[model samples]
Target: MKQFYLSLIAFFTWVIGMAQSGGDSTRLPLTDSIQAKKSTFTIGAVYANDASYYGQRSDERLPYVALAAAYHHRSGFYLTGMGYRLLNDSARLASAYSLGAGFSFPLGKSFTADLSYDYSIYPKFSPFLQAANPHSVNLTIARESVVDLSISGDYAFGKTNDFFITPQISRDIDLFNIGRNDLVSFNPSLDMTAGTQHFYEYYQEEKGIRDSILGILMPPVLGGSPSEQNPTIKTTNRFEILSYNLKLPVSYNRNHLKLEVSGQFSLLSKQAQSQPGKVNSFFSAAFYYQF
Candidate 1:
């Protein structure tokens, strides 16, 4: 994981060096679309502090960096591509990567509809087991990957555009064959910046983790017996997490600086078993800058 982050940092450093030498990073991707007026290239880093176990002081910190190139055409077409990489604190932790694409088109004079898809994947690793007191081992479970697809449209009302409403439906895929989460959200936007916006989004995952993981089999080695090469462990345990998120954008400079902050809360309860879920609430903040 450390090497992964180091490599990402090295790549970005190389890009920055190229940018300093009069090479255009925006033109590096969509060479045909570099003629747009409102195009920009941005880079930013974010730090997030997460607390779990019903907020009982199980805190974790994660940091990541992102880069994006965006273009707005004279025909009202918009396109953007972004790459993000997670920095891991532990050598055994997995580093995550994400690719996002989005487009927004005018629905009317005062409204626009935006469709976006973000695909994220994490490297595979075994759970961490630390010896505690020489007699007990503490197991830290692995984080799963989720693919998020979201579609939203907003209608602006009021003369000053101070008040508006937005409705969106989104789906979350486990990607690892665990389970799927789907939900719809009704969000409202308020004007905060000069033509800038603030939004609140709320949604839920349709299925729980227990139902999702039950069909998947444990590793053959863990289930093997002395007489039988493979055996099945008999235990019925399952749980699901209900989640909600609040998203807010603080700064936007189209070229220089953009900041985003999000807070998330989740409720976990055992369905077939009587164990508590490992996670509780998480908060994340991100920033971007372009030169």
Candidate 2:
């Protein structure tokens, strides 16, 4: 499994090099040349079936709500805010809030590079106390908080068409420990004007032993922190992923409406005994409007 993930990393690195070497002549979107700029506000929402809320196992397909607002300007600078609520059965599982700002700079004729910063807040839990014997811990499952930073560059293969391909790399940080279980990923995308887009990504995550211990104790135990006097378990975790997404893009210029569909599939680690990884899938749709 480690070898496979290493190879995947190499492949993505090669792709990035190739895209940069030969993409100088690619066409640029007409929108990039249009100088008439305006700032607009928009709102959007999404619904997914069989989706895990906040990455919690107890989450079901009941309903998830996302509220968003953005300020976009023609010069390629934007600011956005998003909030999400995940519900399962009849109770709220988790909620998240995010804020971001980004800028797009022309690479040449048609390509653009984007740099963005995002901060997200998730409910907190003490990992130290989470460790306990299977029969002793009876606490409800806790959620993890994460913050992500990413930089991406994309090229437009069409002049008037909306089709383009983008490749991005990102690092995710756990806010709790400031630990480096960070992940690096690549995303390649294709899109059309009707809000349909298809994409595939490869990702790798560094895991730790503490996660394995929690995995073993979580299913059987109800709750309670581990005894402060016990020795802490030690282990390491690393996993690779190949994911595919068919997404519908929502664009609202002004008084316009949009709807899109998206789905994803992922494969997890094979050697992780306690947290052995996952194979999961989901589909979702969205509705949105521009004012």
State which candidate has the highest lDDT.
2
Superposed on all Cα atoms, the candidates' RMSDs to the truth, in angstroms, are 20.7, 17.1
User: What count of clashes does model 2 give?
Assistant: 10
Tell me the TM-score of each prediction against the true structure: 0.36, 0.45
What TM-score does candidate 1 get on C-alpha atoms?
Answer: 0.36
Off by over 4 Å in 2: 1-37, 50-63, 89-94, 126-255, 269-278
Please, what's the RMSD in Å of model 1? 20.7
lDDT by residue (207-253, candidate 2, tens digit) is: 12333544744322535534322212222112221222222222212
Please report, as a residue range, the 10-residue window in candidate 2 with the lowest summed lDDT: 196-205
Q: What C-alpha lDDT values do all the predictions have?
A: 0.31, 0.35
Q: Identify the runs in model 1 with alpha carbons over 4 angstroms from their true place.
A: 1-37, 50-94, 125-242, 248-255, 260-262, 266-280
| Candidate 1 weakest ten by summed lDDT | 198-207
